[model samples]
Target: MAEEALFAGPAIRRLRKREGLTQAAIAARLEISPSYLNLIERNQRPISARVVMRLVEQFDFDPRTLREDEAIGGVEGLVRRFADERFADLGIDREEMQELLSAAPQAAAAFARLYDNAAPASLAADDPFAASRREIERWRNHFADLDVAAEELADEMRLSRGDMGLALVDRLRERHQLSVRILPQEVMPDSLRRLDLHARQVQLSEMLSAASRNFQLALLIAQLEQRDQIDAIAKGARFEDEAARGFFTRHLMGYFAGALIMPYGRFLRACEATGYDLPVLLRRFGVSFEQLAHRLTTLQRVGQRGLPFFMVRVDRAGQFSKTFVGASTARFVNSDVSCPLWHVHRAFERAGELQVQFVSLDVAGEREGGWLTMARTVEGRGEPGETQFVVAIGVEAVLAGELAQARGISLRSDDAQPIGPGCANCHRVRCSQRSLPPRGRKLHFDTIRRGVTPFELASS
Candidate 1:
């Protein structure tokens, strides 16, 4: 088999510009002629193994950049956006979209933002929760500075899973002169937590579990102590409104809370030791399954990175409540709807049991490959009647061999279930599970034949 050529022109050019080094200077350092380097930079010539090594040794370049699909996300996002009926007549192809993203990512992003802003009044532009979700996705759900600070604070506080709640309470009372009070459900009917500044009391609902109480305590600490750091990060995001900024800051505080409970270094080590077992980790961390799954998505510390994981939470009605893409290149992350065939939807039927499925997105060709998804139904935080949610986590199938969850499961494409982002964006015309035809494709209704799907899509 021929070795696949590495066409990393964009990455190389970006690195050169970022380092403020001329092509000729970098060429000289790599022991290559300027003309040859120019050819490599133009993607006419493949970069050699020796040059890759030289780049790593000289500039500490990440080898992953060599295979990075910088435009895949933008192209996929635009593909979905253009799938709308409004842009159906424009007839834009994937190649053109890819070129636009590759040439001017900022412009493409701005255009996407503009389109979002012009959306219907029902999809309010000032929706802070939506803005917070975007902000989380923008940072790939990892806040390095917050993680480091939380870890340091955890070290200083000497928190243990067994007595984490008590420890957090003591820290709050001693450090901030704030008392922790757990009130009955009736007393705080509408509120789970409330901070009375004058009384210096961090009141919590009695309905909250022990784990949730600890998390709330940690979140309060993050808000109070890490206010400056959180505010600085939110300011950098440049949100459109103050509400968005406030929500983003709250999310950062939550990130801090998770980090404090499960320190990155310790969590990563435990995950590796246990082959990324969620049940064991949940028990060890003294956190709910949802909390543990969320924490798994934030283990992206450089040099000590875990597998790039994506997490999503959805109700039985197919409403997505939370989504974090982490560093995965899965296109499904950008879509609002999930494929019905994915394990997440099935998790509702088999509540509490972990449902694992190997799925591949049926995009333009089978280019994105497969993913290993694990889902389980979790009890949502509520009072009288708790809302159940399916919390699902996924990683690229190629990287799932190391996970204990993938044991006895074949990661081969032949065995994997073919899925898509959603019925509207999916190109799987023959899919029986499709609820709606693809957005921009014309439907062919044949009286003579009935296929798996109600209508056959015209092949463009």
Candidate 2:
């Protein structure tokens, strides 16, 4: 097979700037003349296989770094925004999109940003709760260094789930002078767990199950013991404000709690042995369904990787509360709420049952690839009127054959149910469940020409 020519001039230039290297310096390292290197930087010539190998061996740069992963992300964002009917005049095919990403990446990104500023407000536009949720979703629900630190700490502890919970309680009492107490639901009111630093007490509601009690205990320990680590991670995040930083820290505390409950190496092995079986893993690890789902997404450790899964949590009213898309899959952006046709919405009608579906990711959806999805409703322990939430997790379609949930899913079938990212961005012509016309399209009221759907978008 012939070698594919590499035209990643922009990527190379960016790397050169990052490393403070001159064109002559990079050329000397690649064993090429300075003039030839200049031509490559201008994208006038494709990089040879020999030079690509030298760059990899000499500079320790990721192959993907040169492949323009950042540029691809921007291009994808543009593609989604451009799919809207309003952008019909600026039509470009997939090949042209590639050229734009390769030769004019900065221009492509500028266009994506411009479209974002010009796009109409989504459903969550003015809602404060939705705003907070979007901030959490922005992190993609996983932090590599935080996970690594938690894993190292867990390894040192070397305790089972039960023992780990006991250890946390002891550490709080002995080290922080904080005592654990289980209080009646009426006394605690709406709170499941509350920490009274002034009173030196950490209270847990009696309504919580054994697993939940353990989780709450672990979370309290994280807040007290892992405060420094959490703060450090938040500092590195460079959040826009103190409030966002606090939210990020709280999320990291939860991550530490989950990692404590299910240690990385052990949890990964269990995932493989069980074939990613949710119930069995839940029993073995003594964690809630939601905890297990969240933990599943963090098995991103180098060689001991588990299946890449994207997880989302939503309420009965169709508001997305939390989401995490794995690295291997296409990123989901803009709004966390999925298309109306997704099974996550259906989970609200049938509470407490696992709903599985095979879905195709198209122009209408936020994510860029196919998925094998599983969703289920979970009731939270709260006051009488408190709402329950549904948690849905999806893996790339290619991994379906190995998944226990995908046993009878027919991974090869092309009969996947069509779903968009959301109504605001979806442009599928025959979708009966569309809530609104796509942002860029003009609504046509053709009394003379009736179509299958309510609105027929004019072709570009």
Candidate 1 matches the true fold with a TM-score of 0.78
TM-score of every candidate relative to the true structure: 0.78, 0.74
Q: Tell me how far the alpha carbon of residue 48 in candidate 1 is from the true structure, in angstroms, after superposition.
A: 16
Off by over 4 Å in 1: 1-127, 197-199, 364-367, 383-387
lDDT of 2: 0.70
- Cα RMSD to the true fold for all candidates: 5.5, 7.3
Residue pairs in clash, model 1: none
Query: Model 2, 205-244: lDDT tens per residue?
Result: 8888778888888787787678887887677764445666
Query: Model 1: per-residue lDDT, tens digit, 1-460?
Result: 1222456677788888988999899988889999988888888898865676577557745544554442233365677667678888888888988887666555676677677557553565567788777788778788999999999999999988888988899999999999989998889988889999899999999988888888999999998899999888999986778888888887898999999999999898999899999889988999988888889887766667777788888888676788887766465756677888888888888878899998876654443456789999887767434548899998767667768899888877667787877787676657788888876567888899888988687654
Give, for candidate 2, the lowest lDDT window spanning 10 residues: 63-72
Query: Which portions of model 2 miss their true places by more than 4 Å?
Result: 1-114, 117-140, 155-157, 162-164, 197-199, 328-336, 364-368, 383-387
